[model samples]
Target: MKINYSPSKNAFYEEEHKERYLLSGSWPGDLIEVSRDDFIEYGGNPPEGKTRAPGPDNKPAWLTIPLDFVEQAKAENKRHTDEANNYINEQQWPSKLMLGRLSDDEKLLFNKWLDYLDALKEIDVSGAPDILWPTPPAEPAS
Candidate 1:
């Protein structure tokens, strides 16, 4: 008996006995044991199973804020801004607060609050549509 093999599927078949078997050893390349007449008459085409397409080359775009969460986020941002502003008003800059008299922790806290205020100034409150997600780069030609 002669052995026939399909490297793509990692399988083998015995020619005269007409038996099929999964490959147990390393492939020996594309070897056909049956005569062309026998192969054409009996063997039909080999199965080509489904193959997965390659994944996108670039990373997926970031998720946008859902419509339901937008209002909540705006409210939280407003609350934080108000608290920071209140702290600033009570401290009164140019007084001991800004005169380098405060402790290191106090100075750090003040700087952080100032940074928060600066960031709040940049926030867009116009409730713009959420179509600003980054797009993956186009796939290269095959």
Candidate 2:
């Protein structure tokens, strides 16, 4: 029986039994080594990988966003949006005063509130993993 050794797995495969065995010290036990092949045979590997292809060099990258931060941002976004809407609804504009006729202070306050709403709209809460916040670039070789 020809034995095929895989350095990456640190195991040996016997063509006779069509099985792979793990290397423990100097002894090869009867324990069958389970590989990706086994998972495929049993339909263990999920199809999710197909949809989300790996990053560069087939390696996967992950982003860690704090749960508390996400929740707080979402809450703040809702609060600001509601506050802006309420301000618009409660204001009683005079018949002679158009939007442009508003006082400087009123315009500034309204614009500030609208700016907050715009910022909140831009916050992405899809929870999708991203590499936008990458590690600092490595220094160039001297």
Candidate 3:
């Protein structure tokens, strides 16, 4: 993500100076190249670790995009939409809460998993695996 920082506006301050980021304008070397004009004129003029402040009118500009995350998020959203549509069409809408009453077998299965989900809500699962949850224990053979 790209962020633009400039001096405050329509507010009160103790002092006023040129915007810091406006002059620095250090873009990621991989992404942007400093213009020849900027290099010749503003190059190293500020000196080692020089600093400045922005005036009331100074406002910075920035442009950026999350190239990878955007694609991932888009894919995940499409998947969710497809899943929701499929569920609605095939299973039909259940009760507001986990559907209404179910057959004895269905009720037993739902309760068993519902308890597990509820238990999960009480714990942290940030690093949990995506599948084969509540992993089975290893077996010991003779």
Question: Which candidate number would show the highest lDDT if scored against the true structure?
Answer: 1
- Ordering by TM-score: 2, 1, 3
What would the per-residue lDDT of candidate 3 be over residues 1-142, giving only the tens digit for each residue? 2233324421111112224423566322222223344334332323322222232334322213334444554454455445444543453324523556456654454444445444434432221211123321222243
* Stronger candidate by TM-score (2 vs 3): 2
lDDT of all predictions: 0.48, 0.44, 0.35
- Tens-place lDDT digits, model 1, residues 16-44: 44422224454444544544554343344
lDDT of 2 by residue, 17-97 (tens): 553222334334433434444323332322322212222432222224556655665675577677666755565323213
Work out candidate 1's RMSD over C-alphas: 21.1
- Model 1, residue pairs in steric clash: none
- TM-score for each model: 0.32, 0.32, 0.24
**Best of the candidates, TM-score:** 2
| Cα displacement (Å) at residue 101, model 1 | 1.5
* Best of the two (1, 2) by lDDT: 1
Which 10-residue span in candidate 3 carries the lowest summed lDDT?
9-18
